[model samples]
Structures are given as structure tokens and as C-alpha cells.
Target chain A: MTDITNQSLSEIIDNIKTKRISSTDLTKAYIKNIESAKKLNAFVTTTFDQALDKAKQFDAKPNFDQLLPGIPLAVKDLFCTENTKTTAGSNILNNFIPTYESTVTKNLWDSGSFLLGKLNCDEFAMGSSNETSYFGNVINPVKDQLVPGGSSGGSSSALAADLTPATIGTDTGGSIRQPASFTGTVGLKPTYGLCSRWGIVAFASSLDQAGPMTKTIKDCSIMLEAMSGFDKKDSTSINKKKEQYSKNLKNNIKGLKIGIPKEYRVDNMPKEIDELWKKGKKILKDLGAQLIDISLPHTKYALPTYYIVAPAEASSNLARYDGVRYGYRSKKGKDLIEMYENTRSEGFGDEVKRRILIGTYVLSSGYYDAYYLKAQKVRNLIKKDFDDNFLKVDAILTPSTPSSAFKIGEKTNDPVSMYLNDIFTVPVNLAGLPALSLPAGLDKQGLPLGLQLIGKALDEQKILNIGYAFEKNCAFKNKIKKWW
Target chain B: MSLDKEKIKHVAKLARISVNEAKVDSLTKDLNSIFKFIEQLNELNTDKVEPLTSILNQSLRSRKDEINDGKIREKILKNSPKESEEFFVVPKVVE
Candidate 1:
């Protein structure tokens, strides 16, 4: 008998429908796996008792018509789960149990899935290595001491380790893709506004999007279908009908124009990553897709622009975490002003404070024009680069990150080096475009490397199809040996 | 263009985060390095380009102005650190 925990989401659904496995058994398998994989430090909060009860209820009344029938999922801790402790991997939010549910999680529940646990992430979704997480660094299951790329590190780690069959993560500048790249898994950042920002902890409101992290492209499609929709509460939610991505997934890529961005080939990029990108392009070409050399001229400026824009918005958004409201409040401080300062200083992690400081400096009165406004203008140019390239190409192809997973403490000291990890993934967020990162091959170190597919705004179907085609042909069969 | 200690302190104050006295120098160094990296944007001429405020091209949507939700004061104050009679208790703001 196959391990129930090792099955993909679609297979699990099929088994449930066929009465081969009940939701209780599936949930128990995952819970047992999670209990054993404690070295990864992936879960911040596990709802095993609640999960078992829900799974038992689901088994009692099997609903075969739903998208994710009787399935249990662990999501990133960033999403506010009603009556569950929702920490954004920060001391500030360590005690925040939201009274209401985030729209994305609610949607997943509506589709017949229940929460298994909350996974750890970079504090306030700020770091690339998951080191910023107040809970602790999430160990990449690929190798011990290697970081599960962050701020969606725990989501990637949990998915890779089979602690959860499938999971969801919020991507603000490669939070999903880079971790997915680090771990041998699939992560997609949907077009901005596709997933509502209603109850999720706000980072950079514009760039933050919640998407799926799964074992396969098919599972990704299934999870995305359940996780996205229009919510009236989220002002930026796209007013469009729900997409049937899982049902409509097709691998036919004949005559599709895939753009190869010249700018993504950053200097000092790892040789194996370059090889992985080349291999991805070749596989796409072999499947009858036309690869065109394209130039996104403003790509080099995207990282710097993102630094300005994201932090600026984050500084403003995070201001709501004063001592008065929900979350950690400082014991010291005589006055309201001192209280606010002390609470934030003691509550937030180092990286979060650094970003908040940078945000404040840029949005300050004297430097506003030179920093914030200039970055926004540069952002427009970055977006324009994608818009122009999309005229000649249906989707763009690039390596997800410059390198595979680094050691846990390798780049934590140097913030700039850590920021560069998102160079390839940030521009898509800037353009508010949908992109998918699929593990294409493994490096010499036996670590996984991913190739990214960027689609035009609201054209997620195209990228999903391209990724699906690439996944079927590439045949990346690397799996992590369970040492943890 | 470099962020000095004075500037870091001022920014921290503005952001309502107090920097530890011992860590100010290192924080300044990190901020300076980041600012230096961000200075690359200055090289690119973006005078003609408009600042992008929103990614979606559509104008902001407005619905009918009506009170849709309320009366969940207990729920709203459930997570508050210090609440008294539906109001959040804070340190004295008035002298």
C-alpha cells in the first residue's frame, strides 16, 4: 500500500471519491508525518484535534461534488485564520488570533478543505532565507542546514517533506517561487488582485498575492482554483468570474510564443541554474513552442525599485501594529508615543525593522522625490518592459532564482545579498503578472533548481499550460531522502 | 546618499521603532549599503514616465455608501491588548 501522505492532492481526492481512503485516514497520515518531521521547524501552529474532528465530519458526509473534498491543508501563517493563532513569523503578531477569516482561506474552506496547521515564514514576509522567522529557520528537506527559500519557506518545506499534501503561500517578491525553487516543488504567484487581500497580514499591499505550493502542476491548478476569487471586502479584488483552471488544464503548447528575457541571465549566476534554464527552453522548443529572444531593458532596476516600493508600503501598512490594537504590546513606556516605539522595536525582528526604517527614510519629506517617486517611475518602466515584450510573446521564461538553496546562515548577515535572490522573481510582481515556478532539474549538489514562466496579466491559464507541458516533458524525478 | 546614524535615528523615530543604542552603527551600515544599491535608479532617466500608483488600469470602484457591517464590538475587541467597554485602553495622550 502506498503512503497516503505521499500522494498528490488530485490522487487523494480521487481516493476519497472512490472510498479507497477516508478524510480521517488522510488527515491522520499527514498529522503523523508532521509530528515526525519536527526538525524542519515548518509549522507554527498545528490544529491536529480540530483537523481530526473536521476530517471525521467530512468522512461522515462525503461531498464528491466539491473541488477539494475532505482535504486538509496547512497554509502560511500570514493568512488570518479565525480563532486560530495567526502569526506572520514575527513577535509582533505572535498572539494575534483573528476574529474573522481571510477571504482566501474562507474560499478554501468553502471548497471543502480544512486547516491542518499554520506554517512559519520570514518575519512580516521580509527575508529570502526564512531566517527572519521568529519561530526559527525552516530547514529545507533537500539537505540539512540548507534554507527552505522564504518568506514562504515553511510552506515549501512542509510540501516537500510531505507534512501536508498541498499548501498555500503569499508571494511578495518571490516568497512563493524562490522557496519552491529551493525545495523541489511547484509554487505560483497569481496576477495581483486575483486573490483577495482581505484578512491576510498586509506586507506590500500592491505586490502581495496568495497562491498555491504543491507537488505537481496539476495540484497547483487545483489549489489555485480553490484559493482565488473576487471579494467585495478587498478593494483591489478583481471583479471577474472564477476560473476553472484545474478542469481546463491542457498541455498542448504547439505554436505558442515563449519569451526568453536576456536580462534574467544575471552575472555570477550559478552554472547549473543556467543549464537548468537552457534545459527548460530546449524542452519547451521540443514540444513545438517557439522561443523568441526578448529584451526587458528595465529589468536590472527592478530589485532596487522593489526595495523602495515594498518597504514604503510596508512601513505604512505595519503602522497599524501599535501597542493599543491586537498583537504584542510593550511592558515598558510611560506615554503613548513611547509605548508605540517600544512595542514595535521589541516586537518586530531585525529584518522587519530594517525595512521599516528604509521605508521611513525613503518616504520622508526631503527624500520623497529622489527615492519614492523616482522608484515608482522606474517601476512604470519595468512594467512597460513586460507590456511591450508581451506584444510579441505569449509568455516569458526565466530561471526562478540565480542559485539553488543556500546554507541556513550563509547570507543572513548581508541584507543586500539576500535581496538579490528575488531579482528574477520581483519584476513579475512589479508588473502584477502571474508566474509559475516549476522544478526543472537538480544541481551538482543534488539540490533542485527551478524555471519560471511569466504570463500576461489575468492570463494565468497560458502559464499554467506552459508549466504543465514543461513538467510532463522535463521528467524531473528528484526526491529528498527523509533524514529529518 | 548614505544613511548616517542621525538619519537612521530620525527615520526610526518616524517609523515608531526605537533602535537599540548598541545596534545603531550596524543598522546605519546596512541602511547605507541598501541606499547605495537603490541609487542605481538615479542613473536611469525616468523624467517622462509617470509614477505607477496602481497596477490594474481600472479606476477605483465605488459602491453605494451604506453601513454593511457593525455590532461585533466584542469580536473586534477580542484581540485587543487592553480594552475597556468596547474601547481600546491606551496610555494617556492628553497631558
Candidate 2:
């Protein structure tokens, strides 16, 4: 069977322009594939009718000539879709049918993209693995029993498994990056506010960002151009002028100063990932880029710092979801307090509740100074470490994750072990910096190894240029639908 | 005082959780371990370190506070499990 997805975005666009394949066929293929791979649990809800309807409606009148026009793309459940169920993979708000569209989703629809479904995610985007989702864990398309990293696991798994051409996912601390790494897909977390958070459910307000997850750097860039822009509704949204991300794909990385943070090369790194990083460094040198040693000494404190800060913000932001406002409510209670208590206790998953408790405790008056305040200082140091290093190097490089996907149940019992999943990706969030994860190479297990590139805030085009240039030189596997 | 049972209860109540008696021992142990680990943060000489709530080094930006127009109250309340007369109904308390 010819792999429909192996074709790049440019090739797909050309084919669609010539009417070689209609949008209806493309949408049907994905819907069929998603149905076949339903066992992967890649989506919390599949919008089969909606997908076909959008595909046909846009074909009659496409908005533009973009690569993704009439092309089907899945959406992570975290991004609110108007009149569509957006569960964020949690039961508390499982019935949440948003009347408004997230800026990202709105832009996608405006670009004439078709919707596939809402992919599963970590409950409230809280876990590194998708297991915490009330929808059940998304199994890795690569290795069935292992996990697809989360909370964007469903989106990555959908793309990896050939369910859709691309998808959009949110990264708060590493939701997009880590799962992309695990599933061997390209995921970008632009500067904290580069993409508006106006419609997506809040996790960690300061760190949450939305970006594209796709099969290649070029594809990721195309989708990102459609999703990113200024929004008056989202206060943190940057008002900078925008351009097509793919417009700068040809920018050469010659003489680029690439910084390798020495602190991330800790003792426990898998030899395979370390070897992949060294090989990636060599590849950049071969392309005429210079790799320099850099320091981010405060990285060791990042996980601790992120846990405190993210949860504190999450606690405050999630306060709106009380039983009186929206979402699941508890019945069979005598008093208001009992109702509220039972509702939250029964509604939230173990991981979600644990985070709430941790957040509430840290923000409490007595412990606030010791935990949250101190964490804030460490957070500044982490950002400062990046600022001082970025002054010398145009971009920073790090392993997207410690290792490839672990088995589904391996670390589910140990919450701390799971939080460690964000170590490499958290500091960038702390600094409100832009980062991209591309397939650097494959490890011994033949699973993909993801390499992350960090750029200055709102410098997404630079990272886009860097990612596209690297993909041009690197030998990337054609995205096969069966691989998922 | 070793985070006594009463303190745990208070904390759980503040968090609006219903911790069953059987789960208390395990939760206590877990919290103790986590707290002990976080105690290492106290080791840093952060006397001069300034607390930062936002990563951006820019000054705060605020718009004049005004009543903003918002709609779709029915849409917002659609997720609620129980409602009455267009308002979310909860168990009554005090009187």
C-alpha cells in the first residue's frame, strides 16, 4: 500500500491542487485508519462526521493556498473547540462543550483545516505519561504495551500512527515536547505567550503554551504559522507582526553558534541517547555550524522549582471549576461544604488531586515563604542561567527526554519519577523561551531520539529556520502510517 | 510536631478532600518523604535571591478594570452535573 502520509506537506498540497486526491478521500483515509487503530486509544473522541463535513465544505471554497488547507489534523483535547467536546482527558469536565474556540483552533479553521477528533491527554495536562487520563492511557503506536508520552500523547500517537497529517497540542512544562519525543514526532513549544492561551484550559498559567505537533520540522512550521498570532482576548499574547513560518525554512545555519549545556549531561543518561546527542553535534559541525560548551548550572533545581511554581499557579487557576460553576458535581450530600468536598474528591484523578494538595499547601500562608517563594527565586536563577548562556550561543541544544518511552505501568506508582520527565524541557518554560523538538536520530532500539533547540523568546522563526535546515541535512524516515 | 493527624485532617479539609482513614497512613508517609526532599531548598543561601512570579523581566501591564461583556452562560453551565432555574444548585448549608 502506498503511504499517503509519507508525502511531505508541499507534495500533499501539490497533489490536492491538481485534484489528484480530493479532501474527502484524505479525510476518509484518516477516519478509517483511526477506526482501525482505535485500540491505540489515540483519541478521546473522534469527530468522524465533522471531519467529512469540513473536508467537503472547504473543498467548495478553500480560504487560502496553505499546505494544510482541507488537510485533516487532530486536536488535543486541551484546546477548546466551539460546540465540540473538549475533555482535557479529565472526567470532571468531561461534559464541557465550549461555546468558544481556542485561538489555535480558530486559526486552524480559518486556514481551512479539517478536524479529525479530540485526542486523549493527561488529566488537566498534569502527567508526563498519558496513563493519568480518565479516558485511559494512549498506547504507543511504536510499541503497543509501552506508553506514548503525554499529555499530548493522543495527538502524537495519532500522527505517529497515521491517523492524521498533524495536530496541535499544549505544552505546560513538557506536555508537547516529551510526548513528541516519546512518539518520535516534531513538537514545538513557542515562547510562553507566542501563541495565545485564550481558549485552552489553564494548567500552569505562566508556563502553558500551545504549538504544533507533526511528522517533520517543515510540517510543524506550516501548522505553527496558522496557529500563532496576537489575540486581544489573551492578555499575554504578543502583539508582534507575524509571517509564514515556512517562509524562512531556507535560512542556512552556517556559522551558527550552537550551545551544548554541560549540566544536562548528567551521569544517569542512557548511553544510547548520549551517543545520539554526540552524533547530532557532529552532524551540525558537518553542516558548518560550531558547537560550544555552555553551562546551565541551575538545571538540577528546575524540577523542584517547576513543581512548586506550576502547581501554585494551577491551584489558583483551577479554582474556577468549583461545583457551583461548571463540571461534575456531587449529589447525596447534606450541606454545601460536603457537596463541594465530595464533588472535587470524586471528580479528580489521583494525580490531579495530588497536585491540587501540593499546590494548596505550597500557597498556604505558613509554607508559602519556604516553598513557593524560594521556588520563585530558583526559577529566576534557572532563567538567568539560560539568558547568560544564550548571550554566547544563538541556540541551545539538549536531549528532549532522558530516554525513550517507558512501559505503561513502569513509573505510574511513583509520582516523583514521573515528574522527572520534564527536567530537560522545564527550564525553557521557566525562562519563557521558545524550543523545538525534531527527530535527531534513532537509538539502538530503533525508537526515535528527539533533540530540542532553544531560542530567545518569540524567536520562533529562527528556531523554525534552524529546524528546517537541520531536517534538510539529516536523513529522516518517511512517516509511515503503520509505524503508529 | 511531626505533622500530627489533626494537621493532616486540617490540610485535607482546606483542600476539600475526603481522605478515608485507611489512606491516611500512606498519604502521611508520602507527604513526609516529599517534604523532607523539599527541605533541601532551605539549604540554598537565597537571602539575596529575589522572588519572581513571572519569567518576563518586563514591568506589569494592566488595563483599566471595567465590566467586560461575556456571554454563553448556558454554555458555561452545560458541564455542571446539577442545575435549577438556570442556576447551578448545590446542597444548602446554615439555615
Candidate 3:
């Protein structure tokens, strides 16, 4: 009836509460959609038979008090799901199945949501495009050949294509937000440690965070409320009580001071992006918000700093893949050391290898002071920029990316160029701040362009409110003509 | 700040990842370009700033040291590529 797959997560919850649609019916609808949209290459593994069984069990004894009730969601493969193959988009973990569940996924399951499947992502969440995934690049549902921005590319594409109602993604330097921008959806990278990194595959320990990607901001707030909490397992998790983000979401942002950082007006930015930024400002101002011109001077150093810090941590975190306890092991090695070398070299993809090499180089004895430590200090400056700016403003606004989504292989040859895709989004991660990317408008080619709202650390509610107000008032309507 | 083939090999060895002889040249070039970009951080002066190891300024929480979990030996061993009884089988180290 009227495409149950097209309804938002909140609406689906209501339909289930009212007994209008059975969980089995909802699960079947998504399965049908996912099967037809196989060309998108979004799902790495589909658990349809198990999903239907769970749905039937849910429908037999429905519970209305739970947040998700009886929803089935496909999560990004970086998370460790018990008894399920959680690949993290690398051949290294292709045959690996976990006996434990990631804290974030456990929280979702407790909220009455079950797994639909594991979605594809950049190997170890290393690249800006989905091309780095060993499972192959996920096609943007918006257009053929265009990348659905990545490591979270599969999550974004699946949501945008309506294969799953709502999904979760991990953001390390814009993995969640950038892809959300590309695919015309809502993605949030909550402050670092908001969601546990316990069972998730480690990328950069300091930067990796799990967040929700949804079709609407209200659904985003709802999914976020259900997913985030204090977990003793994740040392960095905020030990405070969970926030009632959806209930507290009020769009009246009158007199709220929103900062427009001057440094974000990067050199050679597209005219349409600039126009979108201006339009965003006007919408906020009209909604009774004050737009202050602010400066984040160290913004220029963020990407370079991130490249150093992330890879350094990544090299260390990834050293565990020795082919000893779990994952892929090479048969060709002559001895223990040789086996370790062969397994990593063979299991990892090119982008993953490049990062590992960079990580190894930066942390190497001679280069430690010049590279890793220097970047860490510069990282402090980047954080201080936001810490100082948050004093004068409630939130900061910028364009999500310099431009819209590019072709899959567009910047594969140039790592630095691909890294530049996160220019506007990286600084937030470096500072351990929360930011949301909202689909604001379309570019000249009709590809979706997003506007980012950056909030202070632990201030997700403020940005969500501003984004909610902007989403309601902005002229942009997110409609993708389904060519897939 | 650039890496040569020999240095790339050395770093690959340190990282415990094998680098094929044919791939070393391109890997060196790619890594050199990334380093070239990273070199820009040198322009900023961070002399007095302490390194940011963790974003949360609070001290790590300490819990009483005690056994919290056990009895999942089979479960943990189930994921190993080569398991022998209760342990993971590895290449022999003792000569």
C-alpha cells in the first residue's frame, strides 16, 4: 500500500504501532527492494531468511514501547555483529565472523531493531569514495558511475535507494557526512565517543565514530536517541545520561547565533556551492537566527594534520591483523614474520596499504617528532579554533563538500586530491565535535549538495534544531529520479 | 620528506606488510605526494602546545580489577584460521 518502503523510520514505527503493516510485510518489502537494486552493490551480505524469521517473531508479539518496535536495518560492515560476517570492506576480514556484538548495534537490537545485512564501505574506512572497498565501489543511486561518497557509501546508497528504512555509518573524517551529502540523505557524526568504538573495526582510534544516516532529520534524531548511550566497554563513551534528542527537537531557532566561518570559503569553490551557502544563511536569518562572521584560523592545517594522526593510529591499530588468531592468513610465507607480512599485504586493498605505509612511516623512529607529534600539536590548535568559536556562537555552518559527488574513479590516482573532499568536514572530527550534514540543494548536474552544521562538543541538539529549522524552510526538496 | 623505494620497503617491513618489487616505485611516488601535502603542517608554530592524545580531558575511569567475563574459549577459538584444540596454531618460532 503506497510503497511502505518510501515512508520514513518514524512513520514506519507508527504504522507498526497501529497494526497497519506487519513486521513481516515491512521486511519483505525491503528485501524485494534490495534484490532489485543489486546493481548499486550496496549490501556485502544479506540475511533475508533470518530477517524474515525475526520479523515473524516480532509480528507475533509486537511491542509498542520499544523505539524501533520491529524494524530491520542494514548497518555498515565496520561494526562487529555476533555470528555475522562483519567485513569492514576489506579482504582481510572477509572470512571473519565475530562472537561478540559492537556496543552500538547491541543498543539498536535492545531498541527492537534487527539486522537486514552488512553494507559495503571503504576498506578500514580509509577513502572518501567507495572505490577503496574490496567488495567493489557502490554506485550512487542518484546517478550511474557517480560514487555514493564513502566509506559509508553503501549505507548512504542503500538508504537513498530505499533498500533499508534507516541505517548507521561510521565517520572518520567525514565518512558519514560526505556520503550523506552525495546521496541526498541526513548523516551525523556525533561527538567522538558518543557511540562506542568497542566492536567496530578500528580506523584512527581518536577519530572513528558511529552515527545514524536517515531520510529525514526527525528520523535522524529518533535513530540517534536509540543508538547513543554510555557504555563501560568503550572508555571514551560519555558517562552521562542519554539525551532525548527527538523529544527536545524544536525548530524555533530564534536569536540563536550561527557562525559562518570565513576560512570555509575556500579558493576555487564552485559557484553553485557558494550560492547554496548563501541560501542557507538567508534561510537561517529569516528563521530569526543571527549570522556572525567568524574565523577558524587553523582550518587550513586540519587536513594535513588529520592525514598524519589518523594514519599513525591506523598503523598501530591495524598491526593486530597478523593472521594468527583470526582473519586471512597467507599460505606462502616461510616463517612467522613472513606470514604476517604476506597476510597483510595480500588481504588489504591498495588504499588500505597506502595508509598503512604512511602510518608506518610517520611513526618510524626518525620521523616521529617531525610528523606524528607535530601533527598532534597542530591538532590541538585545530580543536582550540572550535573551542574558542563555540564561545561566541551556538553553531557553525559551511558547505558539506567543495562540490557534489564525482565519478567513482575520478580521484583514485591522487590520494591527496581524494583527501581534499573532506576539507569542510574533517576539522569537526579533529576537534571531537558533533556535526550534521543536511541535503540542502542540487548542483548544476542535479546531484545533491549538502550544507553542514557544526556544533560544540556534546551539543548535537543545537545543530539538529538548526538543521531541522533549515530543512523545513529551505526550498530544496530531496527527490532523486530513480535510474537504478 | 619524500620516500624512496628502499625507504618504502623499509617502512613496509616495519609495518609487517610485504611490498612487491614491481609495486615499490608507484607506492613511493604516491606516498611522496601525500608527504608533500602533509609537509604544509610545518608552517604553523606549535612550540608551546601539548600534544592532544585524547579529546576528553578527564582521567580514564578505573574499575576494581576483577574477572568480568570467561567461559567463551570455544566461541573465541571458532574464528581462528588455524585452531588446534584450545589454542590458535601459528608458525613455529622456537628453533
The reply for model 1, stretches above 4 Å from the true place, is none
Model 3 ranges with Cα > 4 A deviation: none
Going through the candidates in order, the fraction of native interface contacts each one reproduces equals 0.94, 0.57, 0.90
Clashes of each: 0, 2, 0
Candidate 1 lDDT (Cα, 0 to 1): 0.93
In candidate 3, the residue pairs with backbone N, CA or C atoms under 3 Å apart (3 or more residues apart, or in different chains) clash, namely none
Best by DockQ: 1
When 2 and 3 are scored with TM-score, the better candidate is: 3
Q: How are the candidates ranked when ordered by lDDT, highest leading?
A: 1, 3, 2
Error of 3 at A400 (Å): 0.6
**What is the per-residue lDDT of model 3 for residues A1-484, given as tens digits with 9 covering 90 to 100?**
7999999999999999999999999999999999999999999999999999999999989888998999999999999999899899999999999999999999999999899999999999988889999999999999999999988999999999999999999998999999999998999999987888889999998999999999999999999999999999988888988999999999999999999999999999999999999999999999999999999999999999999999989999999998988999999888899999999999999888999889988989988999999999999989998989889999999999998999978999998999999999999989999999999999888999999999988999999999889889985666776787
| lDDT digits (tens) for residues A131-161 of candidate 1 | 9999999999999999999999999999999
Q: What is the C-alpha lDDT of each candidate?
A: 0.93, 0.82, 0.93
True-vs-predicted CA distance for residue A40, candidate 1, Å = 0.5
Model 1 interface DockQ: 0.89
Q: For each candidate, what's the DockQ?
A: 0.89, 0.62, 0.87
**Chain A alone, TM-score for each of the models?**
0.99, 0.97, 0.99
